[model samples]
Target: MDSLIKDAVKSGTPIDGADGLLNQLTKAVLERALDSELTHHLGYEAGDPAGRGSGNSRNGTTPKTVTTVNGPVRIDVPRDRNGSFEPAIVPKKTRRLNNINSVVLSLYSRGMTTRDIEAHLGEVYGAAVSRELISNITEVVVDEIKAWQSR
Candidate 1:
């Protein structure tokens, strides 16, 4: 166990909030999962020494914001040089998950402005959604609505 978590547990601190031990644990888990998922996608684990001559090796990571049911978090998402890997846990370009998107759209549909949605999401769900992100998500919604209307 991490010392912080251990101490928290020993001290009887609650671990249920966005800034609690559980949140930190979730971040670590997501990061490690992304790293390993990249490793699997590349057909070699990181630092294996065998990937030195491979065509596609570890190309470093990009900072990505992911919103889970627990809260909003920033995670380092690993990538490859080939640019073919599409993360299943959180796909490329789409910041929020379906559940989060539903919540965002629901609030937005209820006359909440983009800034209001951003601030409310950050405060309530720990998601630091950027204005650009909100626009992107809404664009997807717009496209879907267009298609639906046409149908």
Candidate 2:
């Protein structure tokens, strides 16, 4: 692990970008977590004898592109024969992850405009987040604040 980081640094790899070390690390971690989730759901690891006669076994994986804080990561989400394995790290049909939302909200709280947040995300993280998406993410917090005030 230390050698990998040293090599990445020696090669001038950027910290955050599509092909950067952080993105690669994030992708690896998420994929590993998803595989763990599938194993838990199936009650056995891949190639285990216990999975031979199981009603629901490992089928394959589906390619999914998820917008994460590092950038958009293309991961092969593991699937099951019963089609009931739902991953909590990258939930099904969730294009954007929560960390990016938190970043947007943190920027907004610091008085950055939606457009500014959009440009910051694009420039810093290489994530093409639009102003509307930033607004929508912050809107949820706004609603919660309003509800709290009303209460």
Candidate 3:
């Protein structure tokens, strides 16, 4: 598993898209890293002539702050059964399981070039990832690194 992760990172695989290697990290690793779930009342509405009162939404969200050795990430979690739940880390609207941002960060840490990363993602993940996007994802660490350095 570790070697696979390293190879993916070195190759610059985009974490987006369904069943991609990077996406698998999210489902198999990140989500399970801090497995948590919550349920809340969505609120109630008056009844209609045809039926009883309705609810605004059956799901309630909880912002889960996941702490990792690298840093922390805030993941929004929605609670619902029947496969209606949507979590920000793995959104309901998305078919992918992994976080592209996380994949980029991992790759950047491993010293992969943006162009290399983009190409790797295209070949391995079947996604056309741009070098600019790879840079942007790594750029997010600038402030955090600076703060750590200053400290």
Q: If scored against the real structure, what TM-score would every candidate get?
A: 0.54, 0.61, 0.36
Ranked candidates, highest TM-score first: 2, 1, 3
The pairs that clash in candidate 1 are none
Candidates in order: C-alpha RMSD to true structure: 14.7, 14.0, 14.3
Selected candidate, larger lDDT, 1 vs 2: 2
Report every candidate's CA lDDT.
0.67, 0.73, 0.47
lDDT of 1 by residue, 1-151 (tens): 3555556677776676667655565566556555655766776767898898788887888998777667777778888888987764467897775454666667877988889888987887776666555655665565544443343
Candidate 3 displacement at residue 21 in angstroms: 26
What is the lDDT, from 0 to 100, of the residue 30 in candidate 1?
Answer: 54
Model 1 spans with C-alpha error above 4 angstroms:
1-14, 98-151
lDDT of 3 by residue, 29-108 (tens): 43332222112122222132432233233344456554433334444555543444434334444444445556666777
In terms of lDDT, which candidate is stronger, 1 or 3? Answer: 1
In terms of TM-score, the best-performing candidate is 2
Report the error of model 2 at residue 83, Å: 0.5
lDDT of 1: 0.67
